[model samples]
Target chain A: MNRIRKNPIFIIVSFFLLINVFFIITAGDSFFQLDNYFYVLKQTAMIIIVASAARFL
Target chain B: MTGNYDLSTGSVVSFAGCVYALMIKSGMALLPAGIVAVVVGILIGVINGTMVAKFNFPPFIATLCMMYISRGVALILANGATIRDNMPPEIGNLASRDFLGLPIFVVFIIIALLIFVFIEKKTLLGKYALAIGGNKNAAFFSGINTAAIIFAIYVIIGGLAGFAGVMSASRLSAGDPRGMVGFEFDVILAIILGGTSLSGGKGSVIGTFFGALVVACLGNGLDMLNILTFWQSILKGIIFVLAIVLNEKVMKNISKKTVAAARA
Candidate 1:
């Protein structure tokens, strides 16, 4: 548990979950749709690819 | 890698996309047009690299100047208009086509992620980048050819930005000079959210992937919730600040723990 607490990935994952929960509460079932998830994936693909360039930087 | 920031990536994306669209509209073959567009991006990178690595200009100032110059040139080339007519049908297909039920761009993302992860984990160049970023003078004394490495990093990033521009054009089915305006902010935000130190020396490609997903999710969720653009921007700002604070605190704790472990 302490090891997980110290991990940066843990923080990020927790933050991600927090945001999802917030959206779920506010937007309800629409936020849980599989199609919306895919839509998010497709929309973010380019940003993910470009953000990878910063990894080199 | 030397804690250098490239502010011109957004402009480079815009410039390269416009060039590709114009070439395709002018009847150039897709492959050739794409190559030229990427080359244009590389050329801009070379200029930026020279300014920073050769002339010793501050990275922020040099790239910021290049940003304006590239955007101006793109606007000129595009005649201040989006180029949509006479584009080849294949351009649209690039964005729409899927393989094995996955979007084509997602495949590209996966390929890019794998290649970059390999480079970061297994290559001498990766070591050199971290070394240079951690301490330039020490790396130089150790015979790292810091300038050359820096140049190469910038050039490679430029090429990637150019390719991204091509993808952007394909998605939009036109090259708008104004496309991707302020996009560098999103890229930087994603990188920071991924926990890549702005001060350099450490980063993770996988982390950046998730960071981008978070940003994308925020945008999509907000839009679905019928949030106004202004409110969405405000929310994103808050999240960005929170991410930075969280990252800093986490890093400090990790460093302190490492120090304690070392002493023990």
Candidate 2:
């Protein structure tokens, strides 16, 4: 378990799981709608994708 | 970055979009309008670089001034009105339409990042940026042209911001001077989350990339739950603070080692 936690993949998956759980509880059935997920992804596509360009020397 | 350099980046994006839209509206060819707008952004970068590097103005102060200037210019150019929906088919098409069965912007992001990764790992400029970030004084003592490097950094950031400005405007099919406000905050947060040190002496393009994705995911997930904007801000604030705390703690030893080496 500790080893898995050290892996970024595990951490990211768990984080998403936690978020998924929280949303499922709060928004209920609406949370399961695939389109909602797609909408959120589309909304921040640029914000998320382009930020990696920082050359912070 | 001690400099409010990122602040001006947001403005550059707005200004570039406005310039592009205005030129296109005035019947310029799409290619010329795009070129002119991006050149305008680069010119702002030159101003920022000169002020900070030559005049010895504090970077934050110089960039803060530039920020307001650019934003104001964008607003004035548009006369406080949004330029919406009348763009030539090519104007916003890069962001709005997909090509080859993939979103164009996504493909752009992939290619741009691949290029960045190559540069960061293989180029002299990238190494200089990392060295300078780690310790400006040390980098200078080691014969790196610190001012030139810093100037180049701002210019690169400026250019990226300019492209982003075009992308956002195109996606919305409008150039709103007020659009992209507070975008710097997101950039900074993304950087921090990627393990880039605020104290200087370290940089990670890959980390920044993943960090940005994580932040976007968090924000999107919250929106899914219909989280109020007020609560979202608070949550985001918490995450930002957490990332900072984690970064400071984890990098403390590394910074200490580098500082010791520099002193030696």
Candidate 3:
């Protein structure tokens, strides 16, 4: 627990999961589908690529 | 690494996209037009680097001026309209084509991720960036050629933004100066969420990957729920603030632990 708390990646992953859970509860099982996951990944790929510039900053 | 901000990134994307589209519309081949667009972006980067590094202008002010200039030029190029007429079939191929059951852009994302991760973790340039960002004066005094490094970083960033612009135009099958408005904010948000300090020095490409994923998931979920665009914007703003607060707290905790360990 303390170890996990210290990891920034863990915190962000937990936050991601929390948001997923919220959507699952509100939108039902449809929110957990693989197709939706793929769509999201596709949409955000450009952002991840562009944000790579921050690696230097 | 110079701890300099490039506020012109979004505008550069627009400008590059417009340039590419205009070239294509004028019967230029795909590869040549793409090259020109990227070169144009690099030119802007050179100007910015010169201003910030050689002239010692504040990064914010210099980039802000470039932002306005680039966006104005983009608007003028497009004549305040999207350029979609007579686009070649190949323009759609970039966005539509898939490899190994993945979109080409997703493949691009993977390649970019690997390349940047390598640069950040395994290269001398990475070390120099960290050194400069962590302490510019110390880096300069250590004979690191700080100006050159800063200039290189800006140029590379410009190239990336230009590529992103071409990708955007390809995806839309048109170039619109008005497109991608405020995109730089999204890029910055992903970096911040990935735990990159705005003050520079510490960050990781892998973390940025997850950060981008988190943002994508949030936007997708919101759209799935049929939320209004205005509401989505509000939620994104709230999340941005929350992420900042959480990141700050986490950084403080880590620092405190490190201090205690050192004392012990």
Instruction: Report the C-alpha displacement of residue B95, candidate 1, in angstroms.
Output: 0.3
Runs of candidate 2 with Cα error greater than 4 angstroms are: A1-50, B1-5, B85-90, B256-264
Clash-forming residue pairs, model 3: none
The model with the greater lDDT, 1 or 3, is 1
Per-candidate fnat, comma-separated: 0.65, 0.31, 0.65
**Number of the top TM-score candidate:** 1
**After superposing candidate 1, which stretches have Cα over 4 Å from the reference?**
none
Q: Give the best candidate by DockQ.
A: 1
How does each model score on lDDT?
Answer: 0.83, 0.72, 0.82
**Candidate 1 CAPRI-style tier:** medium
DockQ of 1: 0.67
lDDT of 1 at B253: 74
Q: Give the deviation of candidate 3 from the true structure as CA RMSD.
A: 1.8
Cα shift from native, residue A37, model 3 (Å): 2.9
Interface RMSD of each: 1.6, 3.6, 1.6
User: TM-score per candidate, in order?
Assistant: 0.94, 0.85, 0.93
Prediction 1 TM-score vs. true: 0.94
lDDT by residue for model 3 (B1-264), tens: 346778888899888988988888888888898898889888988898888878888988998999999999999998888988887767665678789997788788889998998998899888899888778889889989888888888888888788888888887888889887777778878877887766667677887888888888888888889998899889889988987887777767776887899999
lDDT by residue (B1-264, candidate 2, tens digit) is 322245687788888988888887778886777777778877888888888877877877898899999999999999998887566666666676676766676667677778778878899777887787766788889999888877877777777777777777777767889988777778888777776777765656666766666666677667766778789889888989998887777678556766799999
Q: Spell out the clash pairs found in candidate 1.
A: none
